[model samples]
Target: MPSRTLSAMDDHDPLTKAISPPPDETAAEKEARVKSELEAKRVSDAIDDDIDKQRIAEKRGPKPVRVLLLGQSESGKSTTLKNFQLMQDAKAFRKERSSWRALIQLNLVRSIHIILDAIARDYYPSSRPLMKDPNSSSTSPSVSPPSHAMPLPKETYLDPELLELRLRLDPLWKVQEQLARRLMIHESQWKEGLHGGREVVVNSAVAWKDVFTKKMANKRESSDSGRINWDDPTDPGRVLHECAEDMKRLWKHPLVQNLLEKQNLRLEEMAGFFLDEIDEITSEYYIPTNDHILKARLKTLGVSEHRVELNAGGGLGRDWRIYDVGGHRSLVTTWVPYFDNVDAIIFLAPISAFDQVLEEAPKVNRLEDSVMLWSSIVSNKLLERTDIILFLNKCDIMKTKLSSGIRLKDYVVSYGNRPNDFDSAASYLKKKFAGIMKEDSPLPRTFYCHLTTVTDTLSTQKVITSIKDMLMRDNLKHSTLLL
Candidate 1:
């Protein structure tokens, strides 16, 4: 056979025949078909052109200042992010007040549960082991039952009044479960060992705020007044309000306090502690204020990214991206992928945790874990050039612990015979972190250190302002170098 050309073969193709015009097609049909095809081609070309323009605009636009926040659990990473949002977008922050109310109420419920559990444990010693002495050198400060399991006796002696309070507050436990599920925490996540007892842990990807907001919106739509109906029997707030006085009595009982002291279970030191504000937090009309929202604790499973547009300081009218990653030991490896492109890293070390231990790794001291995490971040080759800021966080808590006669030498043996005051201890820990960055870093970078109680709005805002100025100046310098 003679050589067959590609075009000649295409003419006989099935697709070509199917799309071909009818053999008896009119002249008007061809004219109309040509116009339709031209119109479609013009529309497609316009879309392509618009896409190219958008890509070029994105390339030429100012690059956002990206900062990665690294820390172990409860190191104030989320608090710091909230501070940024508060300062940059106060309106948006306040808009979510109702949503935060649910979390604060949940926190209060959890604290109440802890107190009741303590009372039960004290009454029925055979039911569970005593809480570990956090100050002990041999054991972790995290409150967990002993490794040995013990069977409960047939009967135990609990105060009649306390028993009544516990019984009346039984409904709060169901409210806790409801709020957790509403926040997108599945029963499986809890059963699979993703969270500890009554601790709320949800993935960052879940729009938890919307869960509350959408519900409120529907309720508001049904009501004549555009306000949440507090009278709804299903609202968790009602249960909390009804049990308010009993909860207050339970929290303030002298015997309860004595038992807590004996067991070294400082509920105030833990995250989501709201026992002190039961009267205000459990009110039917309760709404979370800025401070309440800052102190409220909700453990997140994955990384959360927040964007803020800055209009003040060196980088005026600049957009910034802050990445808040989960700080649990199991989640640490997930942070590596975000390290490569970040402009700076804010590593929080909760120095106040000198006497406490990691919940995930009970044997390891929390402060020591923070040090190890800091070392890993600074020494990573990928993060060598990125600016690293050290926040020796929880200074306020450390001060209280020191004032209460908790000796630094007892836990940090290296501090032998030094003054056990807050200033001396904070300075010592800051130096320790500085030394690690200096010695272990892959490259020499400036060490920026701040002693912070991130929940303190005025102080934290001042620190945030300084950080913004420093990062913007450095970013400008880098841009100049690129030129």
Candidate 2:
């Protein structure tokens, strides 16, 4: 047997040297030391008791509904989360308004929406209107039409600087939109370096990052130790100059010049100078994601897309923590740390993307690959006991899949990590996850799954109702705290 390394036990604390071996046993000193030890133990015991009480209370407490949302990038996860937060805040406000506890509390719900709208307006250059009409029955004015019932409405805090930016960009967006439309035209008959042909391309609003965000840059200076500065520019002028130069070169072409004149923005050197100023003004408003706190909040909203926690003990409570990672291949690595603490796992697959799913399956010795590679990654990492829900998301858009009944397995031409049918495709996911967990650990003991989407009320309601029943009813046996 090998001796244990000293580093293994290096975690132990060194003994305190405060006490002198009671000088020749002075009774008074000995008694005082004993009393101090007793007090210290009692204090320690009280803390431990409180913690235990909290844990027990939590176990008996209403099982906060824990949900994990995962999906590919641009899947509208952040939007979903923001909407849900708004709804939740609204309901909470309505509840508090009934009681005259605090004036601030009473306005909590309405304030949540206002703050959210303000934040949105600040971040997005062109904000969708916050309210369609106070009396209108429309759910959300800015969200893409056919809004789904989100858990709550959008609400996130931003730093003062970002808030100021969002305010400044409000009117600029309108100007830019108009410019984009007008610039779709051409220039004059003949000018400086006029060429005879070639057309101009008008692009919509500029990318927010390129125009706005500034990054810190290091430069060599005369001082031995260089100075740090926050005024580092993002090269906005350079970009405008380049674009203007390109536009001028294009205007030199006779075809572009004619089009510009029709558009009314004549091909003049003075116009190019004006464009430079427009770019400068446009560069002032940046997306808030660069700030760590704001970025984290945005990330939180994104995660909440499919996952949420409802704390019965609302204020500053140590409720459940949930993680719902995006399902993109690039985002898969983030899921690893979350996996260890997960009591349950939910995997979302678009039923309409069945062909894509078949091509990306991870099993070996099967034909056809799966386009959604994260499905296999999750399957291979899930614990056997961990409750698993294979949500065939976006079923509203995939009703045809259920009717077609075309098993994915039938499409498998050979054996090279291929799933044979739709049923097999799902099974492959479950089994692959189970096999991986069994090989690694022994904790997860349960697995169940279903299909769902947040696109429609009926469908979303069904999914929510199902989840409520599962996490609150069936699992309530183990969690007496769930309401």
The C-alpha local distance difference test score for the whole of candidate 2 amounts to 0.36
Lowest summed-lDDT stretch of 10 residues in model 2?
A: 142-151
RMSD of 2: 22.0
Alpha-carbon local distance difference test for all models: 0.75, 0.36
Q: Candidate 1: list runs displaced more than 4 Å.
A: 1-57, 125-155, 191-196, 221-227, 313-316, 475-483
For candidate 2, lDDT tens digit of each residue in 1-483?
998665755854335334545458788888988898999999999999999996897687654444454554323343334333322332422221111111111111111222233334343425452322233233321111100011122454444543443343233222222222222222221011111111122121222112211111122211221222224253232233333333233324454344444433322211011221223222333211111111111111123223234333231222444454543344454654456435455555454443332112333221222223333444444433445555555444345443456444444333235644445455555565445434443444444555554444345445544655576556633443344
lDDT by residue (tens digit), candidate 1, 116-180: 66666676654532233244333221222221122234576667777677677777766776566
lDDT of the structure predicted as candidate 1: 0.75
Instruction: Write out the backbone clash pairs for model 1.
Output: none
